[model samples]
Target: MFFFFVGGVEQQVRQVLKYGAGRCITCGSKADLVEYEKVLKAFFVPVWRWPGKEQLLHCNDCNLFFPPQLSADRTTTAVADQPDVLRCRFCKEAVEPEFRFCPFCGSSLS
Candidate 1:
């Protein structure tokens, strides 16, 4: 019975790591998962489901954690980011949300 419960909980944790809030960007196990906003010199930071709080790494024998590079790619594999629809902050023209600058005017969005 205990084993079954542990297995289920681990499965849920794995799913969260894959689809829910990010696991440790460094390691893949359960992270500190802190929630806070960041401000950096007029940079419009992308709002994540859970932000701030430094990412904590989980090592082997602690929690099964995947590397940041691999995990990040897998996490977004199932979903596509929304199209950009904000005007270029510098150029003042309609631009895709994902772009870093205005395609028409070539002004930096950041």
Candidate 2:
């Protein structure tokens, strides 16, 4: 008989230190400064957890966690004010005017 274990360590937000702390480098959305923890799972059950040493910027929209120093300081309002770019109606993500599809959400832009 052969058996396999589906288990791994995952990093997750432990606490939000500050909301709207910065912008995500990838998504340009509001990111929170947060403390994080590493959780070890065995057979999909959490077995142990440990707090991370440094705080990071977490984007809820993109589910990305990045270093605070790497985060951008720009606000979403500034991104929305650009008149040259077209935005998707469903995701509101900016798309090129020539694109017939939203790259972010895969929605038809026509």
Candidate 3:
């Protein structure tokens, strides 16, 4: 007798709740708040699907779905308080104002 099983679970964005709601933790790009669903697949075909418990942030550039609390740009108000800090246009990470290069993304600040 032979038995084989090939199945896995994956999360998918069900709907976008808000656009540009946050920043991606992995890629430092804009992320959207979205409702999500979990799907169970068998033999590459979806067998079951259920709604997720809460909304999450979805990065369009990287196709990553993550918790809202895990976003890199969680402290928007804090950044606004610090005027001397410069943000990298490429990665959106804060950099020292005097630095000519972004330490996070190696991009030219000048």
Best by lDDT: 3
lDDT of 2 by residue, 3-66 (tens): 9999999899999999999877666788999999999999999999999989999999989888
Superposition TM-score, candidate 2 onto the true structure: 0.64
Positional deviation of residue 14's Cα in model 3 after best superposition, in angstroms: 0.6
Whole-model lDDT, model 2: 0.82
For each candidate in turn, the TM-score is 0.22, 0.64, 0.66
Looking at model 2, how many pairs of residues clash? Answer: 0
lDDT of 3 at 90: 68
Encode model 3's per-residue lDDT on 4-87: one tens digit a residue: 999999999999999999887666788999999999999999999999999999999988898887665535787778767678
Error of 2 at 60 (Å): 0.5
Indicate whether candidate 2 or candidate 3 has the larger lDDT.
3
Consecutive 10-residue window with the lowest summed lDDT within model 2: 69-78
Extract clashing residue pairs from model 1: 28-65, 84-96, 84-97, 85-97
Q: Residue 7, candidate 1: how far off, in angstroms?
A: 75
For model 2, the stretches where C-alpha displacement exceeds 4 angstroms are 74-110
In candidate 3, where is summed lDDT lowest over 10 consecutive residues?
Answer: 70-79
Location of the lowest summed lDDT over 10 successive residues in candidate 1:
5-14
Ranking by TM-score: 3, 2, 1
